[model samples]
Target: MLKVQEIRELIKLIDQSSIDEFTYESDGTTVSMKKSNTAPQVVREAVINTPVQTTDTKLVKPEPVIEARKEVDMEKENQKTEQENTSISSYDHEIVSPMVGTFYSSPTPESDPFVSIGSNVQKDTIVCIVEAMKLFNEIEAEVSGEIVEILVDNGELVEYGQPLFRVKTK
Candidate 1:
């Protein structure tokens, strides 16, 4: 029988390597592991063939332990995302990029930015420009508010629907 520490080490080695399957049997104990192609995780099975005086025997599987750990990790990640979202006040609105492009704070490098943090704006006010396929598209504030935060920097690549700025709605 392999100790808990040995089994953990073997799992780490198998996860880091290209091996798809592995099996080990000794002293009536057998451990088998197979990697899932679709997901980067391993499926493991353990069987102990201990000789007992009773005729009844059953195979025990330890896969549930691994699955429970995965569930816990997912829950932690969800909590983290929730915390980030809650950091912004409910009265705040986010200005998002309409298309994939390079974000520009100003029309030209030498010109002043259209909007900045603490700057008040109206719904139709042009806050910035997003250049996609060589076409410069002026982005509006969308909501009347004071700029609370600028999420993206000048000349940075912005994705469609990605938040570019946070505004405190008036």
Candidate 2:
């Protein structure tokens, strides 16, 4: 049976490599780990080897492991559907997230939002906050414009360069 550290090392190895799934077994003991879009999915089975404890064939997963770091966007079909869902297209510009993080429209949940639809903003205007790894980062508009649409919901997860807002230039 692999020790805890050995299992962690195997998970790390799987995550770093392009392999989507990994499995290992020895002396009637088996373990497997897999990575998905949201989190690591581990399916564990009890192994009865030597003097080890008896177990059952079951799936056991640890706490949400760090997800594979990458940017995810709408698929071609989703883009088409969203475009059709849009009522109007005043999308002259976009305020995109600079990094992958959790987006917060307001400083705090109780506070008023930084900006809203039709809110006029300057190039340096703060539009939202993106928190990454416990670090809160203020996202700037970087373009003078009127906010035509809010692309992402408050507290929604965002990817690097993901569109957060659609703006119409002043």
Candidate 3:
């Protein structure tokens, strides 16, 4: 495994090199580096006979810089989410799982479903519940529409990005 100083030196080298990223792996040791506007961030991991150990650290670290980096990371995440929403908008409209979990059509076993085919719905309408990791999350219809189809069944396992209902836009 590379020492901390060695990794730091590599970051400096990469920052000076023409490459934008660098990676190395051998004998259960792995190192990855990527250049950003601020500085290069390096992630190191060891997966030897023992359990895996991982660490991600900045060579030129500062408290305010870390906070700024987090904000930038969050902005990237928000942009990615916006792109995904754009893709979903291409559909007539879809009520989808926000996470991987079991789909529940109703609040209780004997209760009627929140929405059915032909049911008119609007943004903020609770279309269903997704039980993820012991948490029952109310899934909402973010767009106004009429439910054209139910894509998933109650108590069925649903994956992230899976469409639970198809809607005809209002």
Candidate 2, residues 68-165, lDDT tens digits: the string is: 22222326547777875673566678899999999999999999999999899999999999999999999899999899889899989999999999
How far in Å is the alpha carbon of 117 misplaced in model 1? 0.5
Model 1: how large is the Cα RMSD against the reference? 16.0
TM-score of 2: 0.51
Q: Comparing candidate 1 with candidate 2, which one achieves the higher TM-score?
A: 1
Model 1: weakest 10-residue lDDT segment is 63-72
lDDT of 3 at 2: 74
Q: Which ranking of candidates, highest TM-score first? A: 1, 2, 3
- Model 3 misses residue 92 by how many Å? 1.0
Task: State every prediction's TM-score relative to the real structure.
Answer: 0.52, 0.51, 0.47
Task: Compare candidates 2 and 3 on lDDT and give the better one.
Answer: 2
| Candidate scoring better on lDDT of 1 and 2 | 2
Tens-digit per-residue lDDT, 83-158, candidate 1: 6787576437899999999999999999999999899999999999999999999999999989988889999999
Cα lDDT, all candidates: 0.78, 0.79, 0.78
